[model samples]
Target: MSCKYIYSHVVRLLNESDTICIEFEDAMFGRPKSIRLLREDIVRFMEIREIGARQILVYMGHLYKELKKKDKADYFSFLDPGNIPTCPIGTDDRDLSQHIADQLEAVCRDSICLIPYNTGYHWILTIVNEDKNMIHLLNSTSNRNRDDTWKTIVTNGVKMYNASKGISKGPGFKILTGNLKQSGSVECGYCVMRYMKEIVDCDDPQLEKMFAGCIKNQYYTQCQYDEVRSEWSEFVYSYVGA
Candidate 1:
């Protein structure tokens, strides 16, 4: 995927679940010279060095880290497709990924680390430092689980994310849900149709069943669809006998 798509999907998924996943592209044993060289830069910069040394170190570190990140291709494996965190703009890695899944769960528990995963091994890891108070507070949020506020926030957030399009997906926008087929035409465009399906024990019937049940006689005259014949053609091509 292009970097832009990867980044956008990352933002969407994060806002959706407030959780992150990572994946790796290779086996745990494959170490390239370039990855080693970049990691050296991170080691050198851990403590203060001279100004000139700092500048060179930072630049080289950034270049090397970026190369190592892409090289790991293994990191993208654990995430659901199109939904993985981008390693920080400049980052390097070492042992944090040895048990990537477990470490990410730690990041989830201790820090809000955006992690990458490997079905098998980690390619690299970028650690993010968030406010310690927030971590402590989120950890303490459960006082017998009565406060449903967090769940509401997460649910509404996911809803908006699904409905949105360009840049944060705000007002005047329409949600397009290709996977959901509605019980009735009015409910079809609402986009919450996926959840509605679960309520009905299935909101998604075959496309033909949905259309046959939902379309009213006046639907043929509606301005929104604008191409009744074409719609029918697509529907027939996808389902029903030729």
Candidate 2:
């Protein structure tokens, strides 16, 4: 399918939700950037399929705006997708745990939970299958030394699950870390969105197609990444300034 066709279809689906009503606008500064599918744009793309993802971004954006009004230093953290908290494994941070649980409970009515995390420089995604008692991690770059983050998410997931559903001891979810294809360093963010896309596009909750599709094909070069970033940067500047 043509890029225009896919984007139009996505926009149609997103508009149906009554929560999203995005429009295409040309950039006024530097050079006009073309709208194309890039790793960076997939969150907006996947948001078309998953209302929870869009709601998360909207809530985070609103939180940042409120914090910014209060002159908070960490306000920008809520705006960036690559700003996952780096609390180590077994950290006893109840506020953070409760906040995560609240975020999940607000959107996640089903058993599955989708999480997007960033380690300052790279982006990774986590999918918790509550029914299957499994946690799968999708990292576009190296998957080494991720045990801490994985464990931290799992630990918090248990807390969130319990709080959201009034459960006692949570089921132990098996952790599975895997690799996704990346064409450039900055593509981690895009890879994270693609991970979400694959999961949403699947027919089965096991997401067999997502696992196979990600491993087989998914990549964006430096130039493509740059174009996407520029386009988004310009759009944000215009939208926020307006």
What clash pairs does model 2 have?
Answer: 39-190
Tens digits of lDDT, candidate 2, 32-99: 22222333343343333222233233333333344345654221222123223655544555655555
Q: Model 1: per-residue lDDT, tens digit, 13-52?
A: 3343232211222222122111111222222222212112
* Model 1: residues with Cα > 4 Å off, grouped in runs: 1-147, 165-242
Q: How close is candidate 2 to the true structure, as a TM-score?
A: 0.51
lDDT of each: 0.24, 0.45
List, in order, the clash count of every candidate structure: 16, 1
Worst 10 residues of 1 by lDDT: 133-142
Off by over 4 Å in 2: 1-92, 130-132, 174-179, 208-242
- The TM-score leader among the candidates is 2
Instruction: Give me the candidate number with maximum lDDT.
Output: 2
Task: Give Cα distance to truth, residue 110, candidate 1, Å.
Answer: 24
